[model samples]
Target: MTFDDPAVADELILPNFNYLGYLAQGSNVAENRINGAFARLLTPTLAFTIDSSWVHQNWPTGRTSGFDKTNIGLKYEAFRDSRHEALVSVALAWGVGHSGADAPDTIQPGIFFGRGFGDLPDSVSWLRPFAITGSVIDEVPIGSGGMALAPNATTGRFDTVLSPAVETLHWGFSMQYSSLYLTKRFDGGPPKDEPLNQFVPLVEFRFDSPRGQNTAATANPGFAYVAVTWQVAAEAIIPLNRAGGTGPGFRAQLLLFLDDLMPALFGKPLLSDRPAHSQIAW
Candidate 1:
């Protein structure tokens, strides 16, 4: 089945996040995922993130398999002026799988670059809030026990992703194209001999209150943002030359500042008089 099918497209989200989970089904396989991640702003210009996820799948024949993955990364803003800003980031990811699946666990390293357009008013800015990002990743096999089973499985893969995104006060959208080319070692050698390559497109909507300024000239904290996302994908597994079917997917999420959550979690009233930094969907 192709990942582009409505069934598959519904499983991915863009502008990504710190935590996520999903479930999907196709004619040939059923998949489930669970993930947790954290992102922290180190300075006005630097940020760091850590993420981990678990994925499990069941084939039509009743065969079940799964993998666990962890990733860490840092991002730095390279240039910022009144009209635009550019940033770069790099990440390292590790993976391990159970069952006899040759999904050979591996370490993948990648780097990404992004640029954003600024200089528009908040109310109408969503129309031109554009950003473009791209990344190249390398995967290297690891561990011993699993290797003995899929001895012919390829050692790893080299992949890349290109994504472009835009957002407004009430909506956001993005498209990502990812390609994975496996090496001709282990068992499957080369892109023509393996199941690889995918394309995904995502759309989202955010609901929030109006923006407000802070006193003493402090930075605007912005209002909380709540959003829902929908995605579609098309995937290919070579060698067999058989086209996989496609699927649809969806996600619902919310983001609030730590300060907002603190009072709510402690059963205190949300400060009623604070100047809103951004619109928030109540």
Candidate 2:
């Protein structure tokens, strides 16, 4: 449910703060990122989303800070089989050109899916609490917008040049074990109200592969505590190779389930008459 969800929007917002400390060019560097997502359901199986972020980095010699490009998108649940706990979705996101950091405008088309094993037979009841979610997006640049610095021949200065932006394939998946499902659906050892029942332990793996570059990958191991109207989660970011990072880092988020927090306002779709409660499981 972290990369992206196949379920229709249950109106929500997530404010996230990420920190990264690593070695860059033999110098220690630290980066802080503030980002969030605002999503709202438009129909029983359709939703709108906006994602943005700002980042600040500290280096040994100086510092740099700026806003990353923003993304606006639409997601549609293409298929679902509640009986089997499977769901699939398609999405198209547009990155605003020059929105920030001079990032090139891009069109990202993606597929998202989720599957829960809750419908398994009694023999595998233990695996019933497990779930998997994943996403695959292709980033296609609209035009050349890459920026680079070049030495000036006439003057002892540097000139900024624009180059072709690289296309990338972004993909990731998360494997989760929901204690909440265990307590609610089966006669488990722990009571429904047990503190551990609120936790969803998960591990997320992410990869970014450029058209002509080596792929960068990382694994994030974490857990999320689910509540009636809110959730809190954290993860340890572990680089899988040199292309990913030089050291470990971590990220955390606070998610607000607006539909649960204020049902009167978000209990129904803005463009449809379907009840908001019709949303599929995450």
Candidate 3:
């Protein structure tokens, strides 16, 4: 449901698919993306994540596709307050460049946080089911940038060109309303096999601002069906500005919690005496 979460106990694997339609130079371009991520707890408050994606584009002139980039990162839970259902984490990630079809490598350092309103007074019990999660990552280029051959207007021939990569700020947040919280606090309990109580509806806002470039913003409205060991989610992407996109798009994701599904293998930290924990609210 969100690009990043503060919880370090989410030991899972997720695969997602996305579609985007945009206008480039007055021509409509469609992009399809397949992405996957794997996360595992190395300690009670530390985790490692690996992710990558492949993108295919259909343009007016032709079609092209390639693996975007690969990212590996470590997340450390810096703070947690169970009474307030709050969490915070610090993360550092490396984007592998030349190994893939993307651009220059990057060093991404980020902060992630999550907070639930359950601590609100009983007078506002209705808001107890709401939660907010956000993240801010700074992507700093590792080298000069990538190079490509482009036609030189003056020379009337192909010439080697340098594509300068600037630092980019990726930030986003998700607002969620969990029926699971409602059921647990007010309904006593939902009927068995009733999936409605396990649903979480959320709206996410994403913005990418690169130095010296117009910021791109997008809104994703979606819902997730969470179970004991797995989750399924879908969202519709809405461009919030001209720089975002020209048309709406969609995405779907499937996440599996290996810790819960295979406790013997994934239930404990790989190199810690502390026991593994689960942060799933439902």
User: What TM-score fits each model?
Assistant: 0.40, 0.88, 0.89
Model 3 TM: 0.89
| Per-residue lDDT over 1-282 for candidate 1, one digit per residue giving the tens place of the 0 to 100 score | 111110000022222221112121123444554444444444433345555555555443343434444555544444333234344445555544432233445565555454444334668554333433444445455544232111112433222222112111111122221222113332211244434322212222212111231111101111112222222222211111111123333232232233234434422212323322221111
Model 2 Cα lDDT, one tens digit per residue, 1-282: 337767666645456887878632233568888888888889877889889889887755556678888999998889988778889999999999878767689999999988988789999887888899999999999987767444455764556677678899999999988776655544433355566536888999998888987788889999898777788899998878877778888889988878878888888878988775443343
Flag the better candidate by TM-score, 1 or 3.
3
Q: Write the per-residue lDDT of candidate 3 for residues 1-282, one digit (tens) a residue.
A: 547778786555456998888732233678888988888889888889988888887755556677877999999999888778888899999999865664799999999999988779999988988999999999999888886444455655556578788999999999999786655444434436565647889999999888998888889999998777788999999988888887899899998878878888887889886786547362
Collision pairs in model 2? none
- Score each candidate by Cα lDDT: 0.32, 0.78, 0.80
Where in model 3 is the C-alpha error above 4 Å?
Answer: 23-27, 148-161, 184-194, 280-282
TM-score of 1: 0.40
Runs in model 2 deviating more than 4 A are 23-28, 148-163, 184-192, 277-282
Q: Which is the leading candidate under TM-score?
A: 3
lDDT of 1 at 206: 19
